[model samples]
Target: MDEKLSKLVQDRVGGAQPVCLFAYDLDRLTEHVRTVVASLPPRCRMFYAMKANSGERLLRALAPLVAGFEVASGGELAKARAVGGQIPVIFGGPAKTPAEIEQALRQDVTRLHAESVLELHRISEVATRLGRIAEVLLRVNLAGPFPTATLAMAGRPTQFGIAEELLPEAVDTARRLPGIRLAGFHLHSLSNNLSAPAHLELLDFYRRTVRQWEREFRLEVEVLNAGGGIGVNYADLDEQFDWAHFARGLPAVVDAFPEHCREIDFECGRYLVADCGRYVVEVLDIKRNHGVDFVLVRGGTHHFRLPVSWQHSHPFTVVPVEDWPSSAPRPELRDAAVTVVGELCTPKDVLAREAPVSRVRAGDVLVFSHAGAYGWEISHHDFLSHPHPEHVYYGDSA
Candidate 1:
């Protein structure tokens, strides 16, 4: 932990109740985003996926830095509008309701990713009813025998995108449908992808596939939505997806791309904000059970679910607290491989398993790194009626 975060842990944790806190350094976030945006090739745009972390403050901080935000639901759209009402937004989701479609059309989003034939029709109907022409990208689930990621959203059997074989029908229908324009195709193939070469290969695949479609259907495509599947490595923080290398390789890909395609949209979620925030919790107790060392903390999957959700032990560092009360015995472990757990009743409430540590004691604080995205946002905060962790935002977007 840095000096400021260390001080924050000291101030927040030590209370009677076990302290669980989420602190965000927005200055760090802003700088990281600026670097990412600057690295992109010309005509390529990044849309921050707000489903990752939609703290109004984060959205406001990112509004100027990013080209736009990509929202998945009407509620997210409303949140985006609330933060940056006039900023451009591309709306996407596998399942969208008619009311949501109507809401999107009324708001005049920049683009919509149609997941199925019926979704295209729904958008057209809604747009026609509202007297608006909707620009759409058909989300394709490519029939790929290609490389995959931790979570494959496409290029396989998934409910995420339109099947490869069903494209012709979808394309014909989109062209025929009133108040709808088939701008291009959306291929968000996978999630948490860690390889830059594989990513470039994927982009090449997209370009080739789009070219083939253009030739076959006699349609001009203005946009090619690669979607966002770039990943962040949690297990080994030192080794990360090489964005610099990936950015350097993009120009060649763009030069080779169809000249008519004007924009390449990367609506990334996890990779953007994962490292900007940290989760801090105080050790409530240390115990030994069934020949296993258990270190229980105030926070659990209820607060940050990324670990159990991915079934990986999240990386953390111990911050020792000096002021242990004299009344109780200080339970401590040395050179221990301990399983960190939370206050939840279920056995599944684990954060780290058999994680080796030099020394940790009851009252010490553990700070989980790279928790900015998909931490609290995806957690079941209401489960077991535990009090929510305090959110502390700093560094300019606060």
Candidate 2:
């Protein structure tokens, strides 16, 4: 780890000022990433979803391991390219304009995962106009009837993948299109709860589709993007996912297809970087109202931006900074139950409504975990024009 970064992490782990501490335990993160990679049968590729976290240091650390990049926009594509990343890149976004399609085709991205019929047509048009063939995959929607409690893709009104029924037709349409090739299929229906059965079902679905396509359309499938949604432990930090179990299941999916080894890609996002980051905020004023005490902080949803955007509830812990220290007595405060609030000037900017924290006062710092996923980048606005939080990556394994 850089000395500066190590000092910063130490400071947040024990400092006074409110700091958004963000660093994944790289050893643990890599263990998880490698396990996920190892689980796949031969020929399957895993791509890190870049929108999850764009910290340059983290990207540099993760670039060498994952198979490719799964980007949703042109800006993300540019960032990946700027870092001298050579992995195949896949673009996924429904409202892509003509210009974006043209740029993607020009760059010859690994694959463009087109969602809607209109976007598919636009990609074809752009490829035809550019006198090129855009390697593409059709997104499929295999959503379940009800929403799963966690952030699974089953029940959301997801405008992401094409309906399962429409996939075959979409594949046939791609075969007929002038400027596009039916490279394969793309799916992200189950967001972060991918069990072995889910993986098997998805692979089987594709296997049947491939056989049907080969027999009827005479088209061979080149790519099978079993989109990634491996869930991480946000609530319980101790229970590690058995990536070996997941890896054990990959071969079944790969062996079934036989020919397309290494062509299957996993679009993983949160599993790669969420555990690596932390958000630290300072305790401001402390007040007691009714039966509950409130500890105000210097950050908000406008700054951290996770609780509000994704309806997420993060875990909080306190580190002794200056206040009431045995020998480091500096600021102010004692111990009591308190709710944490931010300075966003919005009632909804509440960090925690029921945390049993100490009777905190101005200067004390509180740290929150699982902040690396959609923390600052999600629902940010210039509402109060708060300065963006400083993002530092920890290079050394913790």
Identify the candidate with maximal lDDT: 1
> Can you give the lDDT of residue 136 in candidate 2?
86
Error of 1 at 45 (Å): 0.0
- The digit string of per-residue lDDT tens for model 1 on 200-270 reads 99999899989999999999899999989999999899999999989999999988987788899899889
Q: CA lDDT of 62 in candidate 2?
A: 73
Residue-wise C-alpha lDDT for candidate 2, range 1-398, written one tens digit per residue: 33443467556643444465454556656766776676666677889998887666666677778887888888888887876646567898767889888878777687788887777789889998899988888876764442232565533566677776676677767778888887777756665553545556666666676667567766677787777676666556676455666567757767888474338777878777777677777665676778876777767787677766555456777754543433533444466656677777777887666766554555656778767787766756476886566665544543
What C-alpha lDDT values do all the predictions have? 0.91, 0.69
Candidate 1 lDDT score relative to the true structure: 0.91
Name the best candidate (by TM-score). Answer: 1
Give the distance in Å from residue 280's predicted Cα in candidate 1 to where it truly belongs.
Answer: 0.3
